[model samples]
Every structure is written in C-alpha cells, then in structure tokens.
Target: MKAVTIRTFGGPEGLAVIDVPVPAPAAGQVLIRNEAIGVGGVDAVIRRGTLAMYGFEEGHIPGSEVAGTVTAVGDGVDASWVGRRVWAFTGVGGGYVEHAIAAVEEVFPLPADLSAVDAVTLGSSGMVAHFGLAHAHFAPGESVLVRGAGGSLGIMTVQLAAHGGAGAVAVTTSSAERGDRLRKLGATHVLDRSGQGGGADAPAGYDVIIDIIAGADMPSFFAKLNPNGRMVAVGAVGGRPPADFGMAMMAAFQKSMSFATFSAATVSEPDRRAVRTAQFDAASRGELRTVVHELLPLEQAALAHRKMDAGEVFGRIVLTP
Candidate 1:
C-alpha cells in the first residue's frame, strides 16, 4: 500500500510518499480501499506543528476524511458490508493511504448517487457545519452570518442555513469575484472582510452567527447579534483569538446572547449519527452540494496542503488514489 507520512512536522515538504504494508482490520475494525481523500485545514495545522500536541506522533499519516469501499471486515462485523461503498472520519490519521483501517462504528454507507470525491469532501466539514447549526437551534426565517464564508465548511453552512429557510449572510476576504460564488450558493448578503461595509454596519441583527474566523472582528460580530441570538464558533482561521473578550461579553450581556464552541471530540455518537443522516438526506434531495475546488492526484497531496495553507482554496480539495 502507498501512503503519505510525515516524520517531522513542518511544511508540505515534510509529507513524504512511501510504500507500506497494507493494514489488516482487527476486532471491530474494517479495512477500506480508499478511492478519495479530503484535505482539510486541520491537516495543515497538524503538518505545521501548530496542533502537534494533539497526539499525532512523528511518522504519522495526516488525513482524517476518506471515501472508499470496504475490502475486509473484522471480527464481529457483518460480512455483507465487504463490497459496500462507505465514507468515514478516521479520528486519528490514516485516510491518506491506499487502504486504511477504521472502526466499524466510524463508517457509514455512501449514497449511490454521490461520487467518492464528493462523499470524501463532505466528511468532516459538512458534519461539523450540521452539528454547529443544530446546536444553534436554527429556526426558519432566522438570520445567520457565516464568517470565512468562502471556505468549504462556510459554504456548506450557507447552503444548509438557506435551505432551512434562514436568511444567510456570507463574509469573506476574497474579492468580489469569489463573493459572487458565495452569493450563488445562497448567501442573501455577501460582505467583503477587507472593505468598509464588513463590520461598519450591522444589518438587521443576526439571529445566529457562525464564526469560522474568530479574530479582531469577533467583538463587532457579537455586537451585531439580536436579543437571544446564538453564536456557534467552530474554527479560528484568523491566526489569533479575540483580544477583546470584555467587549464581546458586554455585547452578549446587553443582547442576552449566548456563545457556543464546537469540538469534534465533544460530539456525542448520536449527534454524529444525526449529522451523517442529515447530510446524506440533504444530498439525496439535492439540497446539499459539495463544492470541490480542486481534484489532485494522491501523490500531489503536498500541493493540496500548500493551497490550503495559503488560503487560496474556495472549497474542499479532494485527492484521488
């Protein structure tokens, strides 16, 4: 089996492609013949040593999302799933390989109409978006502001919120060119993070604010919330945390607002299952679309990482093995 492994944490150059023995599924596990893999921001963070303490040891594989076919089922698992197509979140790292092993519980049957590339791209990002929106208790006709709206998860957030009958606002630093793409994805309003209209005026205070980019603008975002508004934060791509928590707190108190953070580790099994079910249901109904920005060969994984690190990607990047 071929896989990408990093012996030292650094840049994309640190990721080395090599041949390794195919892993056999142990008890409660299943071995998948990977057809597609998803490259994510967290993988870049791990590669750069920013998230090194998260239990990813040296010589570790770095992919978390995969869409493949089950080639082998371990003890206690049904043999009927042997030839079934599946998508999974391998909590640790192993999805980059030709064949990866995962616990049976982590895998879900893929929809027949969805391709492996799309299924892989929807793995972690789509699930997190679903979880965050659900935690916010989103209601129809509510208003939502999604920061980092040009990214993969952000795009999913916009589409899902709109599909649920919420007014969606997308915020991104990308030029008008990319903002148009977000608008087409269902954003009622597109705010350029680099312009004056970005945070200058709070248009019709948002009922839910999904903050994927938590940086200097967080206080402003909090202030824009209506009474009883909820803010669900999932990612921090701005390279730093908010430096003005006092202001944020004051705004929250005045507006009777609530803030919640999402950690994939803290998501319960039931919640995870619900997300998977919702994603597939939506996809089958054409309410959900996995916008793939690029498709790279598995060997070009390093290039995919570089694109993500530079923040040049508009949507999920999938790797074909």
Candidate 2:
C-alpha cells in the first residue's frame, strides 16, 4: 500500500508519499479501499506540528475522514459490511492511503446517489455543523452568523441555518465574490474577515454565532452576539485567543450572553452516527449541498496542504486514491 506521511513538520514539502505494508483490520474494525479523502484546516495544523502535544509526530499519516468500499471485516463485525460502500472516520491519521482501517461502529452506509467526493465533504463537516447549531440551541427565525465561512464546516453551517428557518444567515468571508457565492448558498448578509457587517441591512447583533476561527479577533465576534445570544466556538483555525479573552464575556454580564467551546467528542457516539447518517441521506436526496473546491490525486497531498495554507481553497479538496 502507498500512503502519505509527515517526514518532517513545517511546510507542505514535509509530506512525503511512501510505500508501506497493507494493514489488516483488527477486532471490531474494517478495511476500506479508499476512494476519497478529506483535507481541511486541521490537516494543516497537524502538518505544522501545532498538535504535537496530542501525539502527532514524524511519519504520522494525517487525515480524519474517507469514503470507500469495505474489502473485509474483522472479528466481531458483520460480514454484510464487506463490499459495502460507506463513509468512515479513520480517527486522526491513517486516512491518506489507498487502504485505511476504521472501527466498524464508525462506518456509515452510503446512499447510492452520493458520489465519493460528496460523501467525504458532508460526512464529518456536516456532523459538526448540525450538532453545533443544536448545542447552541438555535431556534427557527433566529439570526445566524458564521465566522470564517469559507471551509466545508462553515459552508454547511450557512446552508443548514437557512434551510432550518433562520431569519437571516450572515457570513464573514474574504471577498465580495466569495460572499456572493455564499449568498447563493443561502447567506442573507455578508461581513468582511475583520468583523465588519456588510452594510446597513446587516443585523446589529446575532442570535447565534457559529465561529470556526478562535484567535485574537474572537472577542470582537463575541461582542456581536445579541442579548441572551449563544456563541459556540467549534474550531481554532486562526489559532488560540488570549488567555484573558473570557473576561470580555464577563464584562457583558448584564446582556446574559453565553460562550462555550464545542467539539464532536462531547457528543455521544450513537448520536453522532445518527446525525451523520441523516446528513448523508439529505445530501443524496438534494435537501443539502456539498461544496468541493478541487479533486487531487492521493500523491498530491502536499499540494493540497499548500492550497489550504495559502487560503486559496473555498471549500474542501478531496484526494482520490
């Protein structure tokens, strides 16, 4: 088998493709012949060694989600899974390969109408967007603002909010053209990356903020939340905010606003699986959308990381093996 690994940590050049022995499934696991792999900001963070504290290191394969066909099942697994097309979560590594292993419990059956590219796009990201909104207690007709609305997660948040009955769906993006693109995706208003609302038509405050970037600017976005609003920070792609950032929330004590960080890990496995399966079904039935920026070969993993670092990718970049 061939796989991409981080030979060294720093630039995209650090990712090198190498030959390796094919791995077999273990107890409660399944072997998948990967057709597509997802690349996102977290991959770049891992490549840069930002997550080294979490056990990432040299020679680590960096990928989280994949869509493929199950070639075999391990002990305690059902034979019916073999030869089934499905989406799998390969943990934090071992996904950038021709064949990957996933726990049987982490694999979800795919709709025949969904392509491999679409499966990878909506599989993991859709789960986060869906659960994040629910965790924030978003209600119908409430206003939504998605910070860093350029990746798969942000794109899904915009569509879900609008389809779920948000009165206004606003996004903070890099350009007018991308904002225009998001509007077509159901965004009601656009804001620049600096936190400036698009125009006078923009909502003065948001009822719910689904923020993907949590850096120095996070506090500013927190301030935009309406009284009694909830803000959920799901990703820290822009880096961590200052240690004193929470003080801003305390200062607005009278507004009764709330802030908290959200991770899929906080959700029960059964709940996550159910939500993911429903999202895949929705996309297959045309009730949801998956935005893919480009498709690259598995060998071009380095190129994919470079694009992500340059902020050139609008949605997801799928690597076909």
The candidate that achieves the highest lDDT relative to the unseen native structure: 2
Could you tell me every candidate's TM-score relative to the true structure?
0.91, 0.98
Best by TM-score: 2
Q: Name the runs in model 2 displaced over 4 angstroms.
A: none
- List clashing residue pairs in candidate 1: none
Per-residue lDDT, model 1, residue 176, is 78
Runs in model 1 deviating more than 4 A are 194-204, 215-217, 240-247
lDDT of 1 at 310: 80
- Give me the displacement of residue 219 in model 2, in angstroms: 1.2
lDDT of 2 by residue, 1-321 (tens): 889999999999999999998898999999999999999788888899988998998999999999999999999999999999999999888899999999998999999999989999989889999999998999999999999999999999999999999999999999999999999999999999987967899999999999998888898877898999999998988888889988898999999999988988888899998898888889999989899999999999999999988889898999999
TM-score of 2: 0.98
User: What is the C-alpha lDDT profile of model 1 across 22-71, one tens digit per residue?
Assistant: 99899989999999998887777778776666677768898988988999
